[model samples]
Target: MSARTVLLPALAVLLLFALAGSLLIGPAGLSTPEALLGLFGSERGPAARVMREIRLPRSLLGAMIGASLGLAGAALQGYLRNPLAEPGLIGVSGAAALGAVLTLYTGLSAAFSLALPLGGIAGAMAAVVLVQLLAGREAGTITLILAGVAVTAFAAALTSLALNLAPSPFAALEIVFWLLGSLSDRSMEHVWLAAPFMVLGWLLLASTGRALDALTLGEEAASSLGFRLPAIRLRLVLGTAFCVGAATAVAGAIGFVGLVVPHLLRPLVGHRPGALLPASALGGAVLLLLADLVVRAIPTAQELKLGVVTALIGAPFFFALVLRTRRETA
Candidate 1:
């Protein structure tokens, strides 16, 4: 049997288990049976309220956001033919975070519930445009990476400037915490706000799988295979913007899931970029859900931000990956 066939079902099952853990485990200390009862039972009780209101939304958002990051990462990597390509690495997530910060700075978020996400989406779109303009249509891998790095660095600088000039200490703190990323205190309203954009993004990214496979044989070959390069690029940019922007707006700047999940699962899927997308999505969900559980379970005085936890784990992996790449090239 192909590894893809075995890995997909395993990932799906693991995702279910992660979801269950997310739903059942919390600070409230509800027993497994009680949690299940609260989740499914029609009873209007405290357990049910906690299960339905708090944990459910948090779990769902984590899964969705994780999937978004993972799928976007895979798609970007495939399109660029670079394993290191990721939304966060490519400035998409940073730009989205800057947009969310602008909404906060302008107080538009307070005035309009949707303003924050819209702002993020706008920033993400701008980043895509900038990257495309800088890299050019026929840019090589080095050129693309340089463009992304330039964009990411600029976005981070602007974000830092905003924090430095924040109206008040309280506002600065809030922005800092948000940028660190967490799924805490999120409600169903956030889920509702982000879901449509994320779903649309998923559809757009998923549609590129066949094109990505063909492109593995090179751009000329893909064109000969009847895939329109310009259209594919458009879909990828739009899909990534939608996914990363909505996710960052709702859940702050969670990172690394995209960078890590695709690389980890790529070999499992026989290094086929087409096969990697779904697997990465499932793996991302499982990783994030479990990370959420860990943050909650940890006895820290304050809960660690989801982004911090991911960075902590992924930074080492990233270092190792860089070293491995260097060795292979050397």
Candidate 2:
């Protein structure tokens, strides 16, 4: 077989290795075979409880959230026809973050554990609706981006005002943590709470692959090929809000998973919009899980936030992308 045929299997093996490492090694370390057996309940021990109670859900959430963000990124990039487009960059994530922050600041999250994620969905929905009202309708990619820019600025202002007026106790640090993002201490409840919505979001985005591909040539061309722009846009907006919102609600505001994942895998998929969606989802699952693993293993007095790790990796790559895109357009 040619070298071209070898790429996928290699990536698959790498993903498997990442998954294994995530499960086996952490602050509370578990041996390889022991971890596997622990998963099924045969091996009852401290390791088992830790695996079952703590690491397992966090790992699963890492994968699920990463996949959601990656898939959301793929959808936005395809629909907007811009490689720089990502959920967070375009106001969806910011809006969700604002919603989550509101609950956190109000002390409602303390009383109602489920309030954060539900409120996040509401925030994301509001943002999507606003974007639709402001920038929807076959706008060129530049116009959509500018509209997103405007919305992002407005939302940021609103979030800042909320924070300023928040009660004295637990205000600053909570806001910082929520904005920075993390996956630590997450429980099985979070796993169950967020998974269904994330899965539904993925399904909606995944099904749009063909439509995205059709849309690459332009809405007129896609419509000629039987694609409906309004319906596709609606699905994309609602789907992204559900997935990304649940994720942000559960994990705070982990940045760049959506942006980083899709960009990282684009070359592997021959830059095809359809293939980018799933490949990005898988690649994202790997990246976020591995990052979580790294965060847990570090011996720092205070545990590293999962977002800090991913941002360190994502920021440089984002700059490179900007340079490359500018070069291409120039």
Candidate 3:
């Protein structure tokens, strides 16, 4: 059997085990039997309430958001034909965070529970438009990357300004913490709100698998294979916007899953970008779920932010990747 054939099943099984761990293990200290009973049984008790309301939503969001980030990263790297490419390379995450910050800054989030995420989604869509306008129609990869950098810088500056001008220290602290990212206190309402956009984005990204496979032969070769480059680019941008935007909206600015997962899993799939997509998604989900569990397990006065944990893990890996890439080129 080929490596991919083995890899996919292994990853899926790992994901299932991670999901179970997420549901069963928590600060509440429920036993395995009690957790299972709470989830499966219809008892109207505290265990059931914790199982269904708190852990379940947190687990589901972690899986979905992680999958979205992973899938988007694979798609972006494949489309750009650059190993360093990631979902945040196009400014979607920064813009989404800025949007969420704006909502918090203006007190809209306090007024409306969904305003924060809605603001984030809006910001992400706006970034797409700004990027397109800056890159112009028929722009190439280099041009698109440049435009994304510009937008990211602009959004980041504005976000900082919001922080500086925040009405109070508490408001500033709230913005800072939200930017740091966490999955605590999330609800099923968030899951329901973000699910449709993420599902649509996944379908769009998945459809490009064949096109990405062809593009590996060069854009000219992909064109000769009857893949419309313009159409492919459009789908990639929109799909990424949907996935990353919604994820940032719900989970804050969790990073590095996209950058790290595909690179780690690439060789196992024989470096086929098409096969990397699903594997990366599963890998991302597993990574985030495990990270969330770690956040709970750590004995601290306050829980560490999910984004902080990911960055702590991912930063070292990123430095190693940079050195390795440089050595390979040298």
lDDT leader:
3
Clashing pairs in 2: none
Position 11, candidate 2: lDDT: 59
List candidate 3 stretches off by more than 4 Å: none
- Per-model TM-score versus the true fold: 0.93, 0.91, 0.98
Residue-by-residue lDDT tens digits, candidate 1, 54-168: 9999999999999999999999899888888887766788898899888887788889777877788788889989978887886355666687789889999999999899999
Overall lDDT per candidate, in order of appearance: 0.88, 0.81, 0.92
Q: Using TM-score as the measure, which candidate wins?
A: 3
**Candidate 2 structure quality by residue, lDDT tens digits, 1-330:** 754356557656766777777777876656777777787767678878888887788788888888888889988998888777887755777888888888887877888788887777778778888877887676455656776678778878888987888787468677877778888778898999898888888888888899899987888899899988778876887788789878987897777788888877787778788878877887778888888888877889888888899888889998998888899999
Query: Per-residue lDDT of 1-330 in model 3, one digit per residue for the tens?
Result: 877799999999999999999999999999999999999997889999999899999999999999998999998899899878989989889999999999999999999899999999999999988988887777288888998999999999999999999999999999999999899999999999999889988999999999999989998899899998878887888898998899999989998989999889999999899999999999999999999999999979988999999999999999999899899999
Report model 3's TM-score to 2 decimal places: 0.98
